[model samples]
Target chain A: MEKLCRYETDRVGYVMVLPYIIFFLIFVGYPLFFSFILVFHKWNIISPMKFAGLYNFNFLLHDPLFWKSLRNTLIFLIIHIPLQIIVALVIANILNQKIIARGFFRASFFLPVVISGVVITILWQQFYSFETGLFNTILSRIGMTKIPWLINTKFAMPSIAIMATWKNVGLYIVLFLAGLQAIPSSIYEAADVDGATARQKFFYITIPMLNPTMIMVLILSTLGGFSLFIEPYVMTGGGPINSTLSCVLYIYKQAFYFNHMGYAATLAFTVAFIIMIVVIIQRKLFETEVYA
Target chain B: MKRIIFYILLLIATLIFVYPFIWMTTASLRPEREISYLSPLSRNFSFGSYITVFKRIPIVRAFLNSLIVSSSITISVLIFSSMIGYALSRLKFKGRELIFMVILFTMMIPFQITLIPLYVLMVKLGWTDTYQALIVPGMISAFGILLFRQYFKAFPKSIIDAARVDGCSDFGILYRIIWPNSIPALVTVGIITFMNTWNNVLWPLVVIRKTSFMTMPQMVVLFTVGGQAEAQVGVQLASAMMLAIPIVIIYMIFQRHFIASMAHTGIKG
Candidate 1:
């Protein structure tokens, strides 16, 4: 009986984690494995899936819409990556000091992070309205004529990038703030004592110390850029001529809207593969100080 | 002089950040006829737009569905993730490392990659249009587990050791010792999970086919493009504001925690 009790404790230690393991298999592991199988099959629910064998991938390589989605997604990353990091770091630096209303300022920044994306999209749609929008209101006040924020193909992706940045900047601000606080005051004091200019101190002390945080921010923001859907979907309808159609959004359009499940699944796998490759290359280059 | 300039810039930045939301609330207040012609900020606010938004669609029901899904996901995540986190952190069990590696691998894979296959799985199970579609899949979150594990690993192990020596059971150590001491981390996970599930669009769009099962974001998507005619912009804004305001209220209460949780998850996920 004593031996049995001891063995039960020994075995139960691993047993306690059974729930998470089961859930991981169901939700994550199964789906990941199935996506591989799905990429080759041309089945749209109810029809028997034929083994198309590399044809789906071939189509993806040649499809203009796929290429366009990729281009738009890259365009999104271009606008969002640098903008998200810079704004977040600036806000984090400003708030990290002995500022008054620190909590209030922090909340004001983080407020959008909690609001639903669809809501933000809907909200920004009105904000982008050509005539009565607050954007045009500000522009007209600045003596510039009204601009088509979402309707103009050129402006639409940038506008989505703007909204995406706002939605996520709060989280990055906190990250930078954490990184900033982890820097001891002694380093800054030593820099100040050396008569180093504030610019030099910021560039030399702050930037170098925050490298890991910056890497984390870069990986995260890039991931976010790839997954974007709601902003462009709601604000641009992926249009005013497909100007803002993101890769994930395009995949959704093909899979759900048009029932091109095989093509959509293939496109989805390519994106996931691309994200992995991008992160791998990024890690290599980041370690080598090669900025992409 | 520098301080003044900084303050002024901060003020202006805050205004720019907040202007659209303020405009949304004000726009939702204006009379229906006056929506597009008048300035969104200049008009006297009215509750008529709110009435119209509520009346035109299933806004109230959608809000409740979102509340249910977000809360369920958050609560379930907190319970399950914390359980696994405590084990992964404190238990000297075999396969703990393997479990963490699994969590990490799953965390890096984006949702869209798994989404199509998961839909097929749901169809096979005949679980379409049920709350199970929204709640079951994401209740085991990698980000939550990582956050809790990181936090709990830092928790002094002496307490658990003492409890074990005192003949407390394993779950006893978890329930009485770990959970009571884990309020901050739990709240952090709770805030983030609630917000993510609340804001989720793509999954809810795929799973919940019936208009009656629609969550708030899905409803906003419906109002935006789930139509033939031009949706009344004012009513759409009103519905969006309604979805945003409550979650934003919870976020405002736990704002610092929200940022901290999300920041940590960003690094670890």
Candidate 2:
């Protein structure tokens, strides 16, 4: 009788999951398989696909623009990851205190996170304008020569990095704040009794305790860094000599603009592979920290 | 003295984060030539830019399209994910753990990898430029499934058992009992899904070629970047503000829940 009842429940479970399973198979499973097959074929949407084994990957390997985009993305990660950590950590530490109107501060900080990326990019485009932009205007008023923020290639990627950091630092702050709250008050009290200064307490107790959240922020931001698209797409159109062209934007242009579907698929897979490897390394590091 | 210094620093940081938004709003209201005046309190406030934005784009239609797409996605995710969550948590099923693992694994694969194939699939299905292309692929989210599953697992099983014992069917037990008690999870998933879908630009950009079918972000990006409104800075700012204000207002009303929901998801926007 128990066996029969178990069978009946199993049947019901499958029925309940049927819709989700079908949708997932159609949307996710099929596309995943198709994306892989696309890497082996050469076809624009206009013509029938012809098998071109390894040609797309071969082109990707030698493409200067491809290399440039990868380099640009790495530059983005280098600038973004550290800036995100320091700013988020400092602000989070501040908000963790008994500051006045803490809720208002938190909300204001996170305001941009809720806005559309396209909107934020456009707003910043105006700010990064060469002559009449707010930043340039402020510089001139302060007796400093105005600098071209977006037009000049030297400052373009860094300018984007700064805007992205401003847009997203609030999220890491919240994450860090949560991590900070999770640390027991007794630990801080013990540090106080030991006559530890504020700096010592932060480096010794707070940073050590918040290791897991820090790792999580690192992984998420690294993944986000790889998926950099909208900022460059809206801000510069990956231009001023493609200094700000991101890996994903490169893939987007290949497929949509240039109609090299196979090559685009190859680039997309390369990005996914790189992200997976990075995330795996980060996770391994996290595990080692936990074990150590 | 230290506390005063801290407060001053905090005030400066807050202004750095918030001043651009205030500037954007005020600039939108200013005359085109005075848009970059640096003072947010320009004397030449006008509705001219807004009028231009409305005239250029089918702003209302795009807004409605975004509404339809986002709400449809949110509602479907809520129902289907809850159902899957309930089944995975409550029911005795074969390959349950394997199925759950599959769902979790799918979340790791970035959407870019699937973009080309999915676009091709949409084209083959005659879905490009239609609402179906925008709506169908995103109807069920892996993240939503995981969230609901975690929430439902913590819920007391006794209520579901009682409903089952009282001759309720599986669907009935879920709707009548589990759902009523799962408001927090529903709201969290709903808000996150809604915001993501509403703010989604890249996929919609690929699929929706026509301006009439475009979502707000897609429309705004095209308008500015395509040089349609590039000459008029005020109009561009006004279009961006139009795209941003709704979500910002929603965030203000549900600020606490929004923060909680994002923190819970562990994914930063």
Candidate 3:
């Protein structure tokens, strides 16, 4: 009886996971493998794929637009990640206090996150409009000149980064809040016994203890930053000299607009490779620095 | 004094996040000329823009398309991922660990890596511009599968054993027994999948060329970029509000789940 039951269980298990196995192969596995094969072949949709030995990679090496998009993504991340961490941490810290209506406050911050990115982009684009925007209207009300938020090359990426942070910081806030709550109250009591200042307690006890959460926020932010597409695609169309072009957005254009499938595949692979390297470096730096 | 300051600071931060939606709502209601006005009280709001938006595009149809696509993706993910999760968590089958690792590896490879090939595959299969293109690739979320696996791992083994002793089939056990006790996990996965699909713009943008098939976000984006609402700023904002309203309503009802979902998965697409 036991042997028969074991055999039936095994069969049932295989049957259960069968659909996923097939689905993964067709949807994920094959495409992942096909992406590699596509890198060395030039094929427009209507034509037969022609072998182009390293030609796609060679073009990628010299692609100015690709380089610019990479730079823009980095700039966006540079602004976005730090701002996200600080703001989210601060808000999370505040919300951790026994404040009245904390739920309302947390929900308010997370409101933008749930709303579609396209809606936020359109709303912010209007707010960032130079002449007749709400931001500019308030600026003029205060007798200050309107700052061009989206159009100016210097401000465009930063503006989008700020909006993106506002849209996403709520998520990290919740993360940080969870990390904050998980800290044993005894630790704070010990610091209190030592006559530690609040600042000292925050830096010494809070920050170090939240290392894992910090690393999580960093990685999530990095991944989110790399996939920065919809905001720029809608807001500026990677516009005003491609100042806001993201790697994903650029790849979309190359593959879909221009039909450079091989080149686009190469760009996608390179970005994926860079992301992996960066994530690994981050894990190493964070893991070693805090532990050591 | 410090407490008052803290309250004030929190209020200001909340304002920064919450005020935009309020502004959008009011702006959409205002006439085009008054849209740039800072004060909602500065003008008599009207529904002219909303009327114009409805007249200008098949927004109702777009909403239905978004509903169909999102619900189909969500349901499929729920059903498929739960089954895989049950097998991987409970069943001691050969290659189970290997399959789990493969799913994990699939999660790491960014979606852009497969975007071009997937599009080409769709073209080859003549699935482009159809619901299949929008729905098929998203049918099985590896994240959802992992989430369910983690949830099921903690499920009581005694109950599962009892169910098997009672001659309940594996599928029957899953649907009748394991699932009834896993509402939180089901809601989390369902909401996350639905939200991601509903808000997705990139995939639909890649595949769906016909306006009739375009999802809400894609349609609204085109409505904005194609200069359809050009010179009618109020009308543009109205369209954006329509895109946001349904998701906002869902968020309002499932506010806790939204936060928990993100904190649980941390895999916002």
Candidate 4:
């Protein structure tokens, strides 16, 4: 009876996993393999695919617009990741304290994250409006000149990054709060006994202890920053001379707008490749810097 | 003294974070010409913008489409992921390790790389502009499977052994014995999946061109960005409010669960 049950269990295992395997193959496996094949061929959706060796890749190498979008993405990341870390960490540290209405504060901060990005983007687009936006209206009321937030190329990407930070910082705050909780109260007690000042404890003990969480925040923010499409799409349409055009937006335009499937595939592959390299380098640098 | 300072600073942060939303709520009620005034104290307020939005688009249908797509995908993900999770965690099967590794591999490949081919496949299958375009591709997630597998591993195997010895079928054991007891995993996966699908704009934008099939976010974005609500800032904000309010209600009701599950998952839509 045990032997018979063992065989049935094994068969059941196959049955259970089979659905996912089929879904995986149809949705994930085939798409992935097709994407690989697409990189080496030239085809619009309406046309039969013609093999083109490395032409798409060669074109991508020299595509100035593609390079510009990549530069824009890097700029957004540079501004976003640091701002996100500082804001999230500071708020998290503050919330980690024994305070009044901590729940209310946390919920308020996290509200934007749960809402649709499209909605937030639309709201901020209006807020960043050049003429009558709230920021500029306040500026004008204070006897100052109104600065264009999203209209100018120079201010556009940075402005989006700030909005992105606002939307996402709450998540990181929760993460950092969790990390803050994990640090033993005993360490702080030890520091107190040693006559350590608050600033000294924060810099010397808290910062070092929070290294793992900091690395995680860094990675998650990087991945999040790379997926910057909706904000720029809704707000700028990658305009103001393509200043805020993101990597994904560029690929979307290529694939859908121009119907350059093969070339877009090449760009997609290249961006994905770049993201992997950047993430791997980040891990190595942060791990060695902190651990060493 | 320090606590007072912290409180003041937090109050400032709260205003900065929550003030825009407050402004949006008030502005959506203000007349279109008075939108720039930016004060809740303004005398003029009406339901004109909300009515305009309803006149402009089929919002009720779009809401239902979003509801149907999100809930169906969430339920499907919960069932399929747990089943695979059970198999991977408890049962011994050939290629189990390989399957686990394959799912991990899929998780690493960003959705952008495969997007074009996936679109082409959708086109070839004649699924574009259909509900299948939105629902089918997202029915199973690599992350969901891995999350379930990790959760199921911690579940005690002695109970599984006992159930098996008691002549419970594998499906019976999973559905009756394991799943009922695994509420945390189920809720985490379900909420995240539903929220992601609800807020998703890109895939729906890519696949569904028909107005009848547009999801709520997609419909709102297109309506606002496509210039239908041009010069009608109040109407645009009204449409946005309609999109945001449902998610906000859900988040408020399940505030603790939403935060805990999102933080735990570390996966954002």
Candidate 5:
């Protein structure tokens, strides 16, 4: 509270922040450090750990369930990334237009995000019910038989994918809308004066202008797709098969269900490592491709 | 012809996007057995199933639990982080860059990485199954402080200096000079943190063992999966609707602020 050096203010600030800093160290830093140690030894936290060396990592690499979960995560990403981008871009573009009631349209577009994920997931679970779901009701009216959504392995991952995208795309929509608004209107007007068609203006002017936002959206969505936990956790419980078993769900099941803390830690580390590599690659890709 | 067709297609796309949510709402209102009847879009609805869900489950209590957890976390993070944010931005200090960098790095580490350790900490603290477990651990969010520092740095420094000259204490200057200028940033952090805490599932699932202690999302998960051997689809939808209605109402009130907040926060982070 008293003056010394600017350094003293830093000291005072650190003291002010001591509580949070300590909490982060104990909670966040401790877990992160121990998780690595966890990957090395086989323990359920109740039992004495047996040093497993690289066995956990080896087991994770060879484990069929882990591979399946990783594959499922990739499939979720493949579907989610494109769909989130396209839907957000289109909806943001429309909302950005000088059309009527922009606020209303934007609010409607973002409605899903404000709602709870558990609510959204359950809503979709009901929507996915084979016997009495909203999907089936609508399909039946469209002259189709009931589709086994969650139960059928073929449809489960995609079903989860669609629901996840719906619940999350609003966040991306807002991001893109901000980017859209930040683009100088003069660019669009310049294109118009140059006799650019509407589609050309969109392709030439809008797409190029939104590059940074697109990259951010891509990385965020990729992180999201990999961290896929709750939807599949609640809806299908990771499946009729392992069709929708995301890596996080697999780790959760291993740790909580099977009491394989060591194995689950390995799985989490593996996924986190993969996510880091993906982020790095995305940064590289965006850096080179943009402003070229 | 082509333009009309394009407009028609956009309308249809919008319907496809929205129709399931609309149907979910209707089915949630229908009698349980009537949920299977195929006229969700057209059918007249009743509030009976919603009443049934409320009658059958701990929906009201969970709603209150969620409100408390979300609001407490939001308010605490707003207040404390602003204090820290002001000091970090305005006050010169040693190791400031290191501290700032630590906050940035913490953002990059997904919260899941800390979940197990934090859980162990909670159990050891004997704070498990209590609101303290949820609220205290997250009170000084690095993300909020970082965002607020970015905001506060842009405020007029002369005003804070003037307040300091006029015999105001450091905290008083922060409260009187910079705090007013930073309301937008506070709202931004508040909405994001509130929504985040409200939707938090994995940590709460690990920490909270009792159904009586459940948040709305927790209860929604329970009501969906952990009922009598037979689950009623309509009731589950009803539970979701009840959990979501308050959020949607709030979103309607502050839609612009919500959008702006999320946008600036995301872009900054």
Candidate 6:
């Protein structure tokens, strides 16, 4: 009777979790396995599958557009991650002070974070417009020349980077604020007693204490940087000479637009692999600094 | 002097962060000729652009579709995740540890890696342009399950034991005894899941080809990019506002819970 009761409860437990497990299998598990298999075969929606062995990988290796997309993504990270950290840190430091209407200020900053990416992208696209954009209007009023923000290739990626920074900096500010608050006041007090200047205290105490949050921000920013799609898609369509084509967007176009299923899957796997490697390296670099 | 400078800087930062949205709303109310003006106080404040937006796209239908998809996904995630969470945390079941590990492993895999094959799978199932395509794949989140499992693990075991002694089944104990106490967790998961599903663009962009079935974000993107609303900057901004206003209102009311939940989940934006 004891064994039977135990089995009955076990069955109930399995039954309780059964729905999710099945959903996971159908949605996550099957796709994961199929993506791997897809890397070795060519099959558009209408066509039959043909085993294509290492051709997709070889083609990707030789594809200049793939390299360009990878390079563009790196350029985005190079600009965006540092800009995000600096801007977020400065804003967080300011907001951390005992200021009037601090809650109101924080909410105002975070308002953009809650808005959808597509909305932000569209809003900024108009602001970046050459003819009658807000930025150019302001520029011309100040006796400056009107520069095409999105239409110009040299300025397109950085313009997008600036908008992205504005859109996401608030989340990092919140993170940094939490980290700043968590640092005990006694440390600052001791530094004061030692006659440490504000700049000295910031460098020696504040920066060091913020190391962990900085690392987390770095990793998340890097991952987000890799996933750049909707911004360029809405703003530029990866154009003005394809200067803004990101890896994910390229994979998307290849699969849906160009109907190269095998190649797109291969590119997706490569990007995922690259993300893992980059995240591991980032952790090692920052984690060592934290420990030191 | 320093305090004065700080206040000045704060005001400027606030304006910089907030001015575009103010501009977007005002521009949407302006005529085409006046839409380019930076000032929010415009003489051409009218609903003409909004009317044009409504005529160009099925905004109401798209909004309803988004509502249905997000609500369905959120409800299912709450029910199924809580069930699995309770099972993992409270039950003495075989293979529980292994299952938990699998769920955690799934959380680490980026959705981009699974995009292609999942699209193919949906096509094979003939689910394209259907709500099932948009809603089914996201019915349960691994992160939601983990979050609830952590919450449920901390609940007192004595109460659950007493309920069992009173001839309560496990399901009854969960539905009756546990869920009421887990309201905070439910709200956190519910808000996060709802916002994500509501704002999700890429998946719906891939699956739903027809305009009638598009979610708010997807419709807004399509309409603004190259659709009939493209040339009309006022109409485009109006469409963008339509997507943003509802979320902004929700955030205003639930700002505290939203921030707390974000902090708990460690999700950025």
TM-score, every prediction: 0.94, 0.97, 0.98, 0.97, 0.92, 0.96
What DockQ does each listed candidate score? 0.60, 0.78, 0.76, 0.74, 0.51, 0.69
How far off is residue B244 in model 6, in Å?
Answer: 0.7
Which 10-residue span in candidate 5 chain A carries the lowest summed lDDT? A1-10
Q: lDDT values of the candidates? A: 0.81, 0.88, 0.90, 0.89, 0.79, 0.88
User: What docking class should model 5 receive?
Assistant: medium
Best candidate according to DockQ: 2
- Candidate 2 per-residue C-alpha lDDT over B1-269 given as tens digits, one digit per residue, 9 for 90 to 100: 98889789899999999999999999999998888888888777999999999988898899999999999998998888888988888888888888899898898898778988899999999999999999988888888888888888888878777776677888898888888988989889998999999999999989999888999899988999887896678899999999998898899888999998997777655
Give the top-scoring candidate (lDDT): 3
lDDT of 4 by residue, B1-269 (tens): 97778678789998988998999999999987788886765688899999999998999999999999999999999999899988888888789999999988888887788888899889999999999999999888778888888988888878988887888998999999988999988988988999999999999999999999999999999998897897578899999999999999988888998989988877776
| Candidate 6 interface RMS | 1.8
In model 4 chain B, the worst 10-residue window by lDDT is: B33-42
Mark the regions of model 6 whose C-alpha exceeds 4 Å error after superposition: A1-11, A289-292
- Which ranking of candidates, highest DockQ first? 2, 3, 4, 6, 1, 5
Scored on chain A only, each candidate's TM-score is 0.93, 0.95, 0.96, 0.96, 0.93, 0.94
Q: Is candidate 1 or candidate 5 better by lDDT?
A: 1
Native contacts kept (model 6):
0.69
Tell me the lDDT of model 2 at B70. 96
* Root-mean-square deviation of every model: 2.9, 1.6, 1.6, 1.7, 2.8, 2.0
Tell me how many residue pairs clash in candidate 6. Answer: 0
Model 3 misplaced regions, further than 4 Å: A7-9, A288-292
For A1-292, candidate 4 gives per-residue lDDT tens digits of 7657585448778999999889988888898899899999998888799999999999998999999999999999999999999999899998998887889999999888898999899899888998878789888999999887998999999999999999998888998898889889998999999999999999988888888888888888888777888999899999889999999999999988999999999999899898888989988888534431
Instruction: Give the alpha carbon lDDT tens digit for every residue of A1-292 in model 5.
Output: 3443443454557666676678678767788898878889897767787899999999987899999988898888888989999999998887776765566666666777777788778777767878667678779888988888889988899888888888778788889988888888887787788999999988887888889988898898888878788888888889888898988888888877887878888888888888889999988877534442
User: Candidate 5, residues B89-137: lDDT per residue as tens digits?
Assistant: 8887677778788888888986556665566668778988999987888
Please give me the DockQ of candidate 1 compared with the native complex.
0.60
lDDT of 3 by residue, A180-248 (tens): 998999989988999999999999989998898899989988888889999999889998789999999
State the lDDT of candidate 1 residue by residue for A186-221, as single tens digits. 988988899999899999889888888888888888
Which residue pairs show backbone clashes in model 5? A6-B92, A10-B93
